[model samples]
Target: MTDSLGQQKPVNIKALLQACRSKEETFKALVTLSKTLPRLSAEKKTEENKVKGCESAVWLVVEESHGIRHFKADSDAKLMRGVLVAILSLVEGKMLADIQKMDLKAELAELNLSSYLTSSRTNGVLAILNKINTV
Candidate 1:
């Protein structure tokens, strides 16, 4: 099935991130992406799902089938929601071994994302990544 982005069922999220030339362009893309991404239900955004270090409320749910992991996430803040979706896009449907081996920090650095994020936001993203790794 096609996702909201209307490309193909299998999207290359890394390629999408790599396409952004600068931090400003990335944020602009996030604003547009926020409008298109599907959100989690209110019930699913409970304290249990909350990402611990985020300034805004964020939730992530991971489902695994056979060998692939599926991730669903949401955030109260629109920009944060977009950030979560961008992060999720990178790892959703990945196998456990691939997920563990992936260097998310490297990817973020390549995207020049740290220059645009506050310490809290960085920690929050790390917390989300940690959760994904352990799952």
Candidate 2:
């Protein structure tokens, strides 16, 4: 991925997840990007999109148009929002078929991301993955 001038585009969280240097740095980056996820509209924040099994309420909305999935999410907790952003970074704009082929748990494990989270929060991430993959 590049710009018109052929400069390498900044690697996204998906790439960051693949990096081996410092998992803490990658988690920090996820947290930073988490702040960028826009708040879901009142109309969009419904039970249908809400994720379960988390300490906080997390809502994820998956929409597909022309075979590409658009992921939108929000949470009352910052770290959970980071989780949502990380999830969205992996799959947003990707085709459903492509997303289905992804092994998110392994990717997250590669970063040792679970170490930064509680077991239940980790399970929440799994639930988020289930929601995204099922869509």
Clashes of each: 0, 0
lDDT tens per residue, model 2, 1-135: 533322222355556555635766766766775677788898988988888886789998888889988777899887778767666766777898898898878766654466667888888888999988996
**Pairs of colliding residues, candidate 2:** none
Which consecutive 10 residues in model 1 have the weakest lDDT in total?
1-10
Give the top-scoring candidate (lDDT): 2
Report residue 52 deviation for candidate 2 (angstroms): 1.6
* Candidate 1 lDDT for residue 41: 88
- In order of appearance, the predictions have TM-scores of 0.82, 0.79
Residue 104 lDDT in candidate 2: 77
